[model samples]
Target: MTRPRIRWHIPVFLAPAVVIYTAVMIFPLVNTLRLALFSKIDQERVFVGLDNFRTLFFDPIWSEQFWNALGNNFWFFLIHMLVQNPIGIVLAAILSHPRLRFSALYRSAIFVPTILSFVIVGFAWKLILSPIWGIAPSMLDAVGLKSLFAPWLGKEEYALTTLALISVWQFVGIPMMLIYAALLSIPDEVIEAGEVDGITGMAAFWKIKLPLILPSIGIISILTFVGNFNAFDLIYASQGALAGPDYSTDILGTFMYRTFFGFQLQLGDPHMGSAIASAMFAIILVGVCLYLYGVQSRMRRYQL
Candidate 1:
């Protein structure tokens, strides 16, 4: 019997990608985790085990900001899951209609924001929503609804929610495109079968199409979870690193940034920042695991 080839060429082809990933992603992640376990004490980096985590969670000065940022992050995620995903699904469903005219145009227009720079979106929206010069107030005034307009971005109660909605507006197109592709992939036979059983229109969607697209939705949910936790650009672009209105819009990303780089008079603390980053990594890891093992498994079973 001849021995199987070693497949040296396959590894040769994969080596560059592996090396780049290790250098860019794996090494940085491992280093961040390592940094989280040490602290600069008396100008020396000392191994401190979980002391950084302890300070992050239990130290009075740090705990409040950490918990607040965490709560805001949850709210941010909730808004995306509740508002953005549903809107995207609805848009996808509408555009996926067989006879819908100008569907491509609509898709392009909606998806345009997804490709725009976060800085541009943040700045543009800030201007459009500006109380003194924004068109939002003018449009409201034109419609005789000016009374409803307020400085949404400047208020503590509204700042976080406002930023969240802006983010939703910018990214809702992503899930729409995903779901639209899923909807389009539904076999013609399936729809015909649904019709034969009187499951037409919305009924067909709820019964047949939706079940088949559950996996896509599950994937989108996980993506949203991971993306929202790692979010920084939009918030930073719109609200600044301070995430002001008394830090109402501060999420873990901004919190970690402030700690890592130091803003204004606050000195940078890399150790604490690494701890925060590690915490974020852990949260995202757990979320992905739960979705993979629990939600994804159930989705597969449902599909089967």
Candidate 2:
């Protein structure tokens, strides 16, 4: 066979990104993993193998908080998957209608919050939900539903769910945009084909459009999983580092931050913090892998 010329320019063009990624991402990740494997002993770092992880999982003090945080993370993720993604899909479906008026305005209004700063969203929501001098109660009272107004952010039972809904409100546009694009990418011929067979309206959507958007939905699910697990800023900004009323809003990110940096009088433990970070990494990695192997594989088979 004739030899092909090398595309030397490809690697040359990629060199800068490769170098920067290595320095910014790879180096830090490796360092964090390394740190997780060691602990401070006698004012010096010493190799402790998986001792930190052991403490994290089994030690009464750390285990309780760790498990609670892990559970909270799962709940946070579940809320997004159940509420946010479905609502986004519905919104996308509505907006994608051929005769929908001012669809552009509706899209802009919904998507604007996605681009807003998390800090701003968190703070604004906190103020609006405040029991005293807040609009939520006033608005509810105006509609004769003031009995439903409670200090949602301050209650342990409701705090996490409330925060999750706020997050959904802020970022639901992401899934909407993604699904909308996916819907638009469906060939006109496919819709016409469905219509010729007497499929129309909601039937057309459920049978035709939804099937074609499975891959996009799967992608959105994975993104929601990753994003929810990594969530921190909103909780931190709204509820402080403690993620209270009693750490009810705590997730892996906030837990790691508290452990790594220390809050108030609690002393920081970098090794333990790294261990938490490593656990978060493993959880996200395993979830993504499962989706790829379990979900994506099935999706491909179905397509075939």
Candidate 3:
């Protein structure tokens, strides 16, 4: 049997997209990685191989900041995984219930935060949580829980965790919406079959609906991973570039920002910044690969 020759015009259809992708994404990524290989020596730019990376890992000053940021980043991701996702799942499951009254209003109210600017959310929360002249204390007083309130954003022990929870509160709508959509995509016939098998209500959800939505959960996990790792805006807007309380809320994004752009006492080092950027890229790449191979491979998608 003879196979037909591929069309020469095939490239024409892909040319514009390929060109744009290469110019906007591939080129910048390649250039950033290349920049990470070199260092500034005195007044001159010189190729330093992996010296910058070594310095970032071994030098006490740089390594301390890098590790601190990286550790905090992991914790940030962990909080989202533990608190944000579970709440979202519960909310989604509840919202997905058929014959629920005022579903649209509930959805719109819950999702309103997601549409607000991070700056607004961050600063607004900052003000609300402030120790002085904020309504938090008054509200607590009104409820007779005044003693339980503290300046969470000001304390080093609570700063990172507080910011993470704030982020979770602001973004929970995302996973809820995604999971809700996934739940809706499930065929009603499957649920009916579950009911016939005595798997109605929660049991039906656990056995039939949950398994089908595994792919969507996997996607949400990956999205959360990427978003949390790249998170900077909220922290920066509320806490400034230093990410105080003494950099407790420091993450790779803020760390890289400090390195890339001079802040207060430190002069900007583009090479080291590129190295940080490359490290972030490496971490995200590893995470995505593990999700794809480890998690996604084991998750079986069900047809509706």
Candidate 4:
């Protein structure tokens, strides 16, 4: 075979994106990792190797917060995976029905919150869920569930779970849209064949539709995992950087932010903060890798 000529224009076209990504993402990430390897002693930078990590995992003060945040983060992710994706899939399946009226309207209504700013969603929810002057109590009273309406966001036992549900409510549209697209892509012939075999309704979904969308669902799961672990904005907006109710709602993201930037009286510690960030990076990287190698490998994308 003759040698194929390399296209110089390929690099030329790719240069801008490569440069932008390196400048914005890769360089900052590398700098953070480097920062994690050092500490400031008496305002002087000192290389400490893995000492920060050692402290994070072994030292009582730091380790306590680290493990607490990690556990809360996992619980947050679990809640999303269990409640959010299933709800999205159900909504998508209903919206995908050929006879459904005003499907576009239902899709738009469901998706509106996903487009809202995190700050807006968080604060709006905080206000609505507030015990003082909030309508949630009144609404609950209307439904004869007034006794169940507690200040969920202010209670340690319920704060994290409440926030996770709020996040689920806001982002459910993402999986819905993704799975909806995948469902729409299924050829009518395949579905017709499925129907001919007495697979219709939920049966069609379980046997014909679900397997085809496994790849998309895997993608959503990974995305949710990464997003939850990296989550900060909504928590910060709703609960503040303190992640109050005694820090019961703190996740790795808020913890890293508070460490790096510091709160009202706390001094910023960039080195330790970077260490936390690096730890989170590792977690997200491992989760993504598992999804790709463990889950995605088995979910072969159906051609039909």
Which predicted model would earn the best lDDT?
A: 1
On TM-score, the candidate that comes out on top is 1
- CA shift at 55, candidate 2, in angstroms? 0.3
- Pairs of colliding residues, candidate 1: none
166-278 per-residue lDDT for model 1 (tens digits): 99999999999999999998878889988998989999989888888888999999999999999999999999999998999999999999999999999999999999999
Q: How many residue pairs clash in each candidate at the backbone level?
A: 0, 0, 0, 0
Note each model's CA RMSD in angstroms: 1.7, 2.3, 2.3, 2.3
Instruction: Rank candidates, lDDT, best first.
Output: 1, 2, 4, 3
**lDDT (tens digit, per residue) of candidate 4 on 82-194:** 99999999999999998999999999999999999999999899989999976999999999999999999999999999999999999999999999999999999999998
Of candidate 4, the 10-residue stretch with the lowest lDDT total is 295-304
| TM-score of candidate 4 to 2 decimals | 0.95
CA lDDT of each candidate?
0.95, 0.94, 0.94, 0.94
Cα TM-score of candidate 2: 0.95
What lDDT score goes with residue 153 in model 1? 94
lDDT of 3 at 64: 99
Off by over 4 Å in 1: 1-7, 301-304
> What TM-score does prediction 3 earn?
0.95
User: Model 1: what TM-score?
Assistant: 0.96
